[model samples]
Every structure is written in C-alpha cells, then in structure tokens.
Target chain A: MLSFTFWDILSNLLLAARWTVLLSLIAFVCGGVVGLLVLLARVSRSAVLRKLSGYYIEAFQGTPLLMQLFLIFFGLPLVGIEVTAWLAAVLALTLFTSAFLAEIWRGCVEAVPRGQWEASESLGMTYFEQMRHVVLPQALRISIPPTVGFSVQVIKGTALTSIIGFVEVTRAGTMITNATFQPFLVYGLVALIYFVLCFPLSFYAKRLERRLHVAR
Target chain B: MAYSFDFSAVFDYSDVLLQGILMTVQLTAVGTVFGVGLGIVGAAVMTSRSRILRVIVSAYVELIRNTPFLVQLFFIFFGLPALGFRLSAWEAASLAMVINLGAYSTEIIRAGIEATPKGQIEAGLSLGMNRVQVFRHIIISPAMQRIWPALSSQIVIVMLGSAVCSQIAAEELTYAANFIQSRNFRAFESYFVTTILYLALAIALRFVLKMVGNHMFKRRSHA
Candidate 1:
C-alpha cells in the first residue's frame, strides 16, 4: 500500500478540482440557455406555452436534484439510451438550472413594470422584438446579481454529480481519504477548494445586490 | 430491444421505502427546528455591535454557504472521529444538516432583520419598551414575517439536500432506494419509485410549511 503525503494528496485533489470547475461552467452556460427559452415561453402570449413551461419549471423545482441525477444516470440506460456519467450529470443539472434561472429571470422581467409591456405592444413591435430590444435589456441589468448568485449554486451542485461517479473534488476527496486514511485533512481541503471557488462570487453578488438596492 | 418496464421489485421493497420516508421526515423535521433556531440566534449575533462576534458569524455563514453540503457532512461524520469524537451516522447527519441550514437561514433571517424599518424599532423604543421587548415585539416577528417565504424555500432546499445523507448510510429515503436496487438489481425501477416519492415529499413539505407560515403570520397581517 502506498502512503500519501499531504502535498501529494493536495496536488492530486487540486488536479481534480479542474473537472469540478469545468462541469460547473458547462452546466451553468447550458442551463442559462435553456432557462432563457423557458423564460420566454413562460412569459409569452400563448397560454399553452405559458402553462407548459410553468409545469416544466415546477416539475424540476419540486424534485431533488439527487433524484434527477439518479434518474438520468440510471433510468436512461433502461430506455436504451446509455449515457456516460458526464453526459447524465450535465443533462440533469442543465434542466435543474433552467428551472431556477427561468424563474429568477422571469421575476426580473416582470419587475420591468406592466407599462413597459403595454408600451411595447402599442408600438406594434413583434413579441420577439419586444423582448430583444426592450424587456431583456432592462431585465438583464436586474438579472445579473441573482444570476451570479445562482452560479454559486451551480458550483455547489457539481458536488452532487460526484455521487453518480464523476470524480469532482468531493469524489476526489473520498478516494484520497480512503488512500491516505486521513478524512479530516482531505475533506477539509476539499471544502476549502469549494470555498475558494464560491466565496468571491457570493461577495460580488452581495455587492451587486446592495448597489441595486441603493439605486432603487 | 424494447424494454418492458417492471415495477414488481419496487413494490416488494415498499416497507423499506416507508421506513426510509419516516426517517427522512424525522431528520428533516429535527434539522429544520434546530436550524431555524440557530438562524434566529445567528442573525441576531450577526447584527450585534460586538465586532468580533459579528465577524465570526459572518465567516461561518460565508464558509458554510460557499462549500458543498456533502463535504461538510463527510467532515462531520468522518473528520470528527479522528479528532476524538465518534458520532453515529444519524447524529453526524443531523448535526451537519443543522449547521448547514443554520448558516443559510442566518443570512435569510439577517436580511429580514436589516429590512425592518428603523422607524419601527425607534417607535418601540420611544413607547417605553426595553431592548428585549422591542426586539421580541417589534423586530423579530415582523422580520420573520417579511422573510418567511425565503426561509421556507431554504428549509425545503435543506430537506432535499438531506438525500445526500444516504451516502453515509443514514437510512434516509435515498438509502432505501440504494438498498432496494442492490437487492433486486432494479436500479431504474427503484429510483423511479423513489423519485416520485421525493417529488411528493417536496410538494407536501412546501404545503405544510406554507400553512404553518400562514397560521403563524396571519395575525401579523398589516391590513
């Protein structure tokens, strides 16, 4: 059996942290796109789209992301669509992020005041034009803070993907502890890595929020 | 190959699933109670004039909030034993959940505290109310009223996060799912059943929490 030193363990876990960062970026970007589409449908003039997207958000929101990950990782194989852990993780997390981002973005959009919507309509602009030119520009400014805040969530969420067998930092921590027989030091480092990744975003999000609050 | 779905194996594990659900409910209930209590105290401490206490509370909130809950759980369960404290999986899970929930609800409740108008607190003070009286009567309850929805959502998120406790073999709902899958080799079917149960639990929890919030805060209605 090979005995691992603190530096060796830290260096190995540090390498694994890259995957965590990559997975979070992939999930956040993909989820952001899906969430925008959901936001559009959720706020559109068509009642059917509105209702369907509403349920879509609810179904994702009302379930645990752990369960979603299991279903995607385990359930898809049963249906003859075998997915790698990476693929399944991204799919489940993207849907999860879409739901939350859609909800948050919709709140910002609605906060643009009802008069903006009516004004855009009265200007005879198409629905897409209204959103592209008017609604999103204003809403995007308001959306930045919460959206950045949610990125912290997406980063934390990548930790759960480790359960399905993708070796992110937390999974790497477990494997290292088993090897080194030092759970305290290993898991503490794992947590510190996550803190390093997440705290700056949280602090910036708070600053943005306060700036917005002061502006309002 | 067209796969015909079979759920018979899942049904065979129904009793196990029920026990898992019971344990989950117990863990979540206890975690929420203690977590919210910590949140209340933490929020107060976060806002107090004692600069050291304030910095300590803020550091706790930032550190916990930034890290993943699973790592936190592993630290409590595995790390503590090395430091001369051995905890049962249940004890470790509960403590981790409580601490995690506490850090979160601290921020949420602190927001509510900050949102309390200065006029309201001043009014209480001018009306011959002491600090404690004004805090209890004029500040805390109203702040809770303002932040109830956020607090409720955080509570539910922690409930869902409890699913991770099964990793440490805490016998929660996900643990049951894992157990059934191991027995029947029906991973898909078992997880499907467990997923629906989780969805149902989340919905039921949200409803129950909302009702409790409504009942408690109804009399404080501004109108």
Candidate 2:
C-alpha cells in the first residue's frame, strides 16, 4: 500500500468527484427517460402494460440496488455477456432511479386532476392526445419540486456504485483512507463533498415546494 | 457454455443466514425504537421557542438528510475510532441508522405536529388544561396518529438501509451472503437466496407494522 499524503488523497477524491457527477447525470437522464415511459405505461389504458410496468417497478424497488449491481456486474458474465463496472453501475443506478422516478412522476401526473382529463376527453381527444396537450402541461409544473428532490436520492444512490469497483467519490475516499490510514479525514471530506453536491438540490426543492404552495 | 447452478451450497448455510436475518431484525428493532425517540425529541427541539435549538436541530436534519447513509456509516464506524471512540460494527451501524431515520422521522413528525390546528391547542387551554397536559393530550397523540404512516415507511427504509451495515462486516444478511459466496464461490446462488430472504423479511415487517398501527390507533382505523 502506498503511503498517501493529505494532498494526494484530496486530489484523488476530487478527480473521483467528476465520475460521481457524471454517473449521477447519466443515471438521472437515462432513468428519467425510462421512468417517463414506465409512468405512461403505468397509467395506460391497457391492463397488460400497467401490470408489466408495475412488476418492473416492484422488482426494482423491492430488491436492493447493491444486489441489482451485483447481479448485473457478476451474475451477467455467467450468461456470456461481458459488463464493465461502468455499464453495471449505470444500469443498476438507472433502473433504481427509474422505479423511484416513475412513482414520483406518476403521483405528479395523477395530480393533474380528473377535470382536465375529462375536459380533454369531451373535446374528442384520444388518451395520448389528452395527456400530451392538456394534462401533462399542468403536471409538469407540479412535478418540478419532487423531481428535484428525488434527484438528491439519485445522487446518493450513486454511492452504491462504488461497491462494484466503480471509482466514484466514495470509492476514492475508501482508497485514500486505506492508503493514508486516515478514515476520519477521508470520509469527512467524502461526506462534505456529497453534501456540497446534494444540498443545493435539496434547498431548491424545498424553495420550489414553498413557492408552489404559496402560488396555489 | 453450460454451468449447473448448485443451490444446495446456499441452502446448507441456512443457519448462518438465519443468524444474519435475526441480527438484521434486532438492528432494525433497536434502531427504530431509539431513532423514533430521537426523532420525536428532535422534532420538538426544532419547534421549540429557542432559535438556537431550532437551528441546531435543523442543521442536524439537513446534514443527515443530504448525505448518503453509506458515508455516514463509514464516518461513524471508521471515523469515530480515529477520534478515540472505538465502536463495534453493530454499534456504529445502529448509531448511523438512528441518525438517518431520526432526521427523516423528525421531518415527517414535524409536519404532523404542524398540521395540528391551532384551534385544538386553544380548545385544550380553554378547558383548563396545563401547558404540558394540553401538549400531551391535544398535540402529541393526534400528531402521532397523523404521522404514523410516514413514520412506518421511514422505519422500513431504516430496515432496508441496515444492509449498508454489511460494508463494515456487521454480519447482516448481505454480509452473510458475501461470506457464503466467498466460501462457496457461489455468488449467484447466495445472493439470490439473500434477495429472496430480504423480500420475505420486508413483507413480514410491513404486515407487522400495519397490524401494530391498526391496533395502536383506534381512531386512525376508522379514518
């Protein structure tokens, strides 16, 4: 083990912080897209699509992300597919985020009110057209605060990617702590970095919620 | 490209797995009890008359809420030892769970408390109730009933988060699976079994909480 200095550890952690941000962005974007699909399926007229999406959400939400990561990273190789740590981390985090985002967005979509849906339907709009033109516009405004709040969860969930050897912030901190034998300083900095990354989103989420509430 | 999956190896470790499950249950129980108590106190402190106390409690809530549980676990488990306070993996894990859940529960319970209409407190005061009596009789019970669902959900989250303890070798279900997989080199089988066991435990815990909630709050049942 190399004897790492404080400066060396700080530099490594800062470098790894880039990966953390990148992973969060990738997971959040991918999850948001997939989650939108799942949300649409969940609220679709077809029972089959709704049930399938429900199972997808339940399976992802019920099982731990660590297990999902392990299954993707280690269990997949058994089936002749080679998955890198990045692929596994992104896949696991994306699936995890999708389940939660689907649920959050579903709540927002449903909060668009029955009257709007009725009005769109009375105008001879199809389900898709109704959601596209009428309901979703209102829901988007209501969804902002919760979506931002859930992003904090997405960012925090990325820490679990470190378990699969993805050298993100937590993993870097672990490596530095192992080398420097300074768990306190290393993990403290890690926690501080995570807080710095997450706190603004959290504060903005709260501010948005308050502003929205006042507007209502 | 054919490999036979031998689940027997995983099943043979049932006793070890059970022990880990019990430890998880124990950890969840202890953490929930203490964490909920801390949450109640923290919520009260946050709503207290003293601005300093409110600020301190708000800081604690925000700090814990914003940070990941794994990092917090590492901080307590590994970081505290460096500060001359050595804690066992179980102690550190439980403490971290308490801190995490307490912050969340404080927020949930605070919302419940705030939702208690001012008229109810005034009504209690008008009925010749002392401040303490009024708070206990008018605010706490009703607030608890209102927040029980959110509190129970947070408790389940605490239970799920107990798996993070395994990172420090707390010997929970996940840790047990890790040990079994390393010993038997049956990673897939071991984790499959572990996942199923966790699912069962989560279901059982949810049922139990629902039953307990039903039993504890009579008015809530009607609502």
- What's each prediction's clash count? 0, 0
lDDT of 2 by residue, B1-223 (tens): 7768899999898999999999999999988889888988888787669999999999999999988999999999999999899999988988888899889989998998898899988999999999878768788788888989879877876787787789998988899999999999999889888877877887788889888888888765575
Q: Best by lDDT, which number? A: 1
Evaluated at residue B215, the lDDT of candidate 2 is 83
Interface RMSD of each: 0.9, 1.1
- CA RMSD of all predictions: 1.2, 1.6
Candidate 1 lDDT by residue in tens digits, A40-116: 99999899999999999988887788999998998888878979999998999999999999999999999998899
Candidate 2: global Cα-lDDT? Answer: 0.89
Give the clashing pairs for model 1: none
Best by DockQ: 1
lDDT of 2 at B78: 92
Chain B TM, every candidate: 0.98, 0.96
List, for all models, the DockQ compared with the true complex.
0.85, 0.74
The models' CA-based lDDT, in order, is 0.93, 0.89
Runs with alpha carbons beyond 4 Å of true place in candidate 1: none
User: Which residue runs does candidate 2 get wrong by more than 4 Å?
Assistant: A1-5, B219-223
